[model samples]
Target: MKLYVLSAGAGLLVGIIYSLLNVRSPAPPLVALIGLLGILIGEQVIPVGKQWLSGTAFSTACAKAQAVNHVCGQLPGRQQAGQQAQSAEEKQS
Candidate 1:
């Protein structure tokens, strides 16, 4: 949540600066967003592809590459899982 807020704030700041300079954005907002989405998904392709080529299952390849988490952001269930893991580690300590 904080990261999202910070990202929005940073974008807002840059928009303001561009507005003050009378500069148009490089791309339309919707197009830029879609392009960014593509870039994020594209980044995971190679790692996932390599794992798959090595005979790993699709789901396991994605998990090993953390492609879903990277593209979708850390989900609620993932956060809970991470917290649980931390608790278990602390218990063992």
Candidate 2:
């Protein structure tokens, strides 16, 4: 029982260190840089993508996708204008 416990503890320690030292999510710096750039580009691209997106999601476009893009682009401006108008009306009353 004591021997088994010691072996288990040793195995656990070795596994932990092996995972720490040999584990890698290694990416080439160029590849990582390109991936990061892709994300930034995609942020801009995804909105444009929605306009032409079809309802079919797999190969083409999606309706929800377009709606999300449309709302995200328009909502803030609409809200700000509404708020300003409301404040002006409140002051007049």
Candidate 3:
């Protein structure tokens, strides 16, 4: 996809620049990756917490699951087409 290509290009450019400057990345690759993951999880907590506090049983659980799905739906390169398939199956029964 174009988005992936663009991101890869940007990362490659940064690596080249850093190499030319003889400077290390701001953090170790693993540490930086973990920090990014933390940021993503933190973004979903508030919305999911609000859903939990406002709803009753069954709906609350469904809402919480949906909230998580929505959060994950935003991640790059992930597809949510299967969610439609699940909805279709639910409707048939």
Candidate 4:
């Protein structure tokens, strides 16, 4: 939720900058795609940074950040698969 709010705020700032510069609201498709990609990667920075600061292994930090999931989003049936995995783990425990 906080991440969403921050994302909206960043977008609002960019929109204001664009308006002041007389740039169009929606940039060209290539430019927009690049920007969206940057946003996706940027969102992982803080989580990774925090883990790094705490001395976690780089691979572990990346796993905790779930960067791929954040960028590509959940696939079809991913939630159910994850739940089943969790249940299996609990059964083992």
lDDT of 1 by residue, 8-45 (tens): 99779867866887767896788668757976898899
TM-score winner, 1 or 4:
4
Each prediction's TM-score against the native? 0.53, 0.27, 0.39, 0.61
Worst 10 residues of 1 by lDDT: 14-23
Candidate with top TM-score is 4
Taking the tens digit of each residue's C-alpha lDDT, what string does model 2 give over 11-77?
5775575467664335467755765565444555565476556334532343434444443455335
What's model 2's lDDT at 40? Answer: 48
lDDT of each: 0.86, 0.58, 0.66, 0.83
Ranking by TM-score: 4, 1, 3, 2
Q: Which runs in model 4 stand beyond 4 Å of their true positions?
A: 1-8, 19-23, 75-93
All models, RMSD in angstroms: 7.9, 14.8, 8.3, 5.6
Model 3: pairs clashing at backbone N, Cα or C within 3 Å? none
Tens-digit lDDT track for model 3 on 1-93? 999998899778867866786757786888667756765676666766676677646457546556555545554224456677888899999
Q: Global lDDT for candidate 1?
A: 0.86
Cα lDDT, model 4, residue 23: 71
